[model samples]
Target chain A: MKPILPFLLFALLLGFSCSRQVQRIETDTTIDLSGRWNDTDARLTAAELVTEIMGRPWLERHVSKTGKEPVVIVGMVENKSHEHIEAEVFTKELEKAFIQSGRVRLVQGGEKREQIRRERADQQNNASQSTMKQWGLEMGADYMLQGSINSIMDAYNRKKVIYYQIDMILTDMETNEVVWIGDKKIKKFVKN
Target chain B: MKSYLFTLVFALVFCGFAMAQSSDQNPRAQQAYEAYAEKADNSHAASLGATVDKTYEAHDPILIKEQRREDRREFRRQLRLERARRPIIQNNPFGYYPYW
Candidate 1:
């Protein structure tokens, strides 16, 4: 009976464990902000929102007049969140969306842009007549796109609440006035 | 015996969680988590941006390690500055003598 005691106990434990399934219930008190926040996704979403608001009007009023895609530069995107988020990733998505819409034009911002323009000009100045005629193209951006990221968080040990806000604005370069503004927010609750 | 085993497992899990909570409460741990979260967020943005351009690449551990070393040094430097922000003591009853 003494020897059987241990075996009986072990069997009982196995049976008890088998009888119950572990249930993972997310509490209202907890916030989960863990996931893949791919740049492409952020950009694409931002672009869609922009297009929905400004694409049609901009196209009808200005884009149609040019008969060519109007070139625009994506400008500075600031991160004001606790997380060091790169605003450009989402900007890229917006860039692609505008391009795909075929309603407007897009150009690189900053030093990258200056380098491209300079290289083109240099090629034009230095190249043989045939090459210069073949490849010298000068394009100017008509507008600038800019945005900021901000976040709010409240939590105690084992539970948290987090909210993120991304705001973007498009301005006419010639006028220096904001033409379109877009905002998106993501909120999450996680419990540990 | 079964209940005893269960209690032991429960205790271990509870203790592990308690330790984690305590560590997270520590100022150093909070700073580390914030730093990591910031980096993670930026990396996400970078990865997302690169992916949009179809230019995303896998992280290089060697580069990451080198960067981390620099980050650690910067973190320590920042900690010193933060510590200095607090009021300094000129003299105290516990001290042997006052400052010059």
Candidate 2:
């Protein structure tokens, strides 16, 4: 009877455990990731902005189709939202879309470029004569992509309304000319 | 005491299985939702925008409701598929690991 009691208690514990919510693991979830991209909400907003920008036939016409394309770099994207939303998620998606479409040339953005240079320097110094000695190749960006995300929030205690607007502008590196612009917005409300 | 405890455990197991099975269906509905959203944005821009604004004002929970419904359907479909493919266990809720 005592042995049976132990087994019964063990069964109860196991059964209880199954009803609990699954534990969340530390992984990218669209909103919290840094360095590479922003959270999910920001990514969705960015994708919308990309769609808006691509819809502009006039902007497409202006973008030069030189056989030897100029490098394009991602510049600062300001977060003007109510919450600490990852803004780079928009830029990263924009960069990806540009690359995938095979429409524009892209250069390594921000710190990633510097890291590549540093790695190449180390390889050139340590590797033998047969190794590729290329480090910090001479490349200049023709345009810089920049953007911002802004939001407004109105809440009366338990009830709340949120509005998000994301904007992106592409500028000529040499002439400082604004070439293309895109924007996306999202509005959400919560109540109790 | 054992019979009552077993019944409670069985109920809990069934509830848990139901919840897990239902969760799997959300992705399918979500895909449908995305298509609906895109079409709405394209075809009826002004009206859809107004609708979206109104829903956002209320923090639209349509996604949540749809997801729940989807999960239930998927759970049922999965059970049907499983039954068709394999033998059923009639007596035990936890046939393999009863304690757990």
Candidate 3:
């Protein structure tokens, strides 16, 4: 009976210690306990890449030549990284940057663009003539931005050093000329 | 004899409740949260020209919704990473998860 009392007391204390806790924290709180890739990494990389791609000489040159903002379409990003890193996520960040900077125009690509086309086709047949958007009036993309996500990892016991390198290239679609290059490299040392 | 046992049980229950209350007042957790909050406040002041140390309130509802969504995503990602790090407990050796 004495042992039972002590055991029950200990169990009660353990339960209290192990109780799940919820704490509301700041959105920007940088909590990288395991540190694979996190929101902080995504956000900082996107912001930095945007600054790099927008502040370059290509924007001024293109604007001076064309007398208007250059239209850019995000092309396919190849993921050569070990992890299943979605390339669209990074590309979408770049697209958002282009619009926010007001330096360039963004055009949808891939399935989304085709979906819009399908809708336009539907509208042409089903809707009134005045409300229908013209197909041929679509703005042609002046440049295509593409990139790759590559990573290198070194592991020894419970420690690991992961280095991710994202390389982006902006090319003039007409001339196939490389205009701007944006590179974001992140290295993290994670200990388990 | 019955009264002693009842007293013991009641004492254990009370102790547990007290501990649960104190757990939330964890110093380390509070410090980390305050550090992040201070940084966010500073950035807010510099960017939006808001008064320093004022509790942040988003003027736009869309911004608050987006921030909450992003924070939830981050929390889920951390949980997933933590789970992945744990050793497989069972005898199944195929590691059925393709990506793992």
Could you say which candidate leads in DockQ? 1
Tell me the TM-score of model 3.
Answer: 0.59
TM-score of each: 0.48, 0.53, 0.59
Q: What is the alpha-carbon lDDT of model 3 when measured against the actual structure?
A: 0.76
Per-residue error (Å), model 2, residue B45: 41
Q: Please tell me which model should have the higher lDDT, number 2 or number 3.
A: 3
Give the better candidate number (1 or 3) by TM-score. Answer: 3
> What docking grade applies to model 2?
incorrect
Interface RMSD of 3: 20.0
Residues A23-122, candidate 3, lDDT per residue (tens digit)?
9999668899756767777777787788899899999999999899999977756667656665555567778888888889988766667778899999
Better structure of 1 and 3 per DockQ = 1
Off by over 4 Å in 2: A1-7, A10-40, A57-70, B1-100
Model 2 error, position A182 (Å): 0.8
Top model number, lDDT: 3
| Candidate 2: residue A46 Cα off by (Å) | 3.0
